[model samples]
Target: MNAIAVRAATPADHPRIVDLLTRSWGETVVVGHGVRYDAAELPALLAERRGRLAGLLTYDIGSEGLEVVSIDAVVRHAGVGTALLNAAAELAWAKGLDRLWLITTNDNIDALRFYQRRGMRIEGVTRGGVDASRRLKPGIPLVGDYGIEMHDEITLEMRRPVGSGIAQPG
Candidate 1:
């Protein structure tokens, strides 16, 4: 993790960032669902800051608010995720966003736990969402860890109480 600092993604980081996303997704969900997609579609969202592979994050503007479409921490378990999560939330709040949310596949138990520990709550479930997503990005699969069909997407959110510190719950 040498020189691996927690900074915003830069235009230069797009290649490495996409490489990370492609490799992460290719080995991850593709074989199960039997699909494919252009990883380049993700770079615009992973905009750069200080350069290097610090991390990647993208926002989704909705009627309700801006949601976190994707988040990639350069070094897992190095507080990188927390830093990014806090940064995203602060920006969302400043811009008057109602909440910040993201989606994770069913087999991502580690991520579920990580976000949960960071005060994010499982708000909803998208049954068959994975199937729908496969139409766009076929790399997703019906099978995940332990041979479980990755049939759903879990929606997570950070809800902030007005005038409270952070939107995250303990």
Candidate 2:
């Protein structure tokens, strides 16, 4: 397979990113920080392999924290997700940020494993977090992957001093 290339998304990538997020997340609206983020309009990083959109990651950096709002990969198990994650970490570290964080549903067992393996710690698990989120966007389904009821949002994070390398599996 061709090497994946990662870069900051351009305006032209909007429609495709929207489509991908819509299909991947069941919608294009992401709820975080008690507000909604239009994933397509947010600045993002895109990963391309063989000229195809391999993955995309959207984030928001602020004094509060750098939150990875969304990340999806069309090519599974091809390092697309990992590359995007590492790139996000590098960006956060460069900006002198102390941490990188994201939220995923409790039903996302795959994501839980992936994040932990990639050196992200389970910072917190807010019970009923998804329930609160649904109040903002009712489109969020009650049931999620593996037919499990979605009830909570798991917050995961990775932290390192600026200029220190992020951990990666061998």
Q: Estimated TM-score per prediction?
A: 0.74, 0.92
Clashing pairs in 2: none
Model 2 error, position 163 (Å): 5.8
- What C-alpha lDDT does candidate 1 achieve relative to the native structure? 0.64
TM-score of 2: 0.92
Q: State the lDDT of candidate 1 residue by residue for 1-170, as single tens digits.
A: 24334444557665676676655555312211223324344322332235545566655556756566667665677666677777777777777776878788898888899899888899888788788787766655678876778888888888766886567652
Please give the RMSD to the true structure for each candidate, in Å.
4.7, 2.3
lDDT of 2 by residue, 20-129 (tens): 99888788899854668888888899999989899999999877567899999997898999999999988877778778899998899999998888989888888988
Error of 1 at 155 (Å): 0.8
How far does residue 62 in candidate 2 sit from its true spot (Å)? Answer: 1.6
Candidate 1 is scored at a TM of 0.74
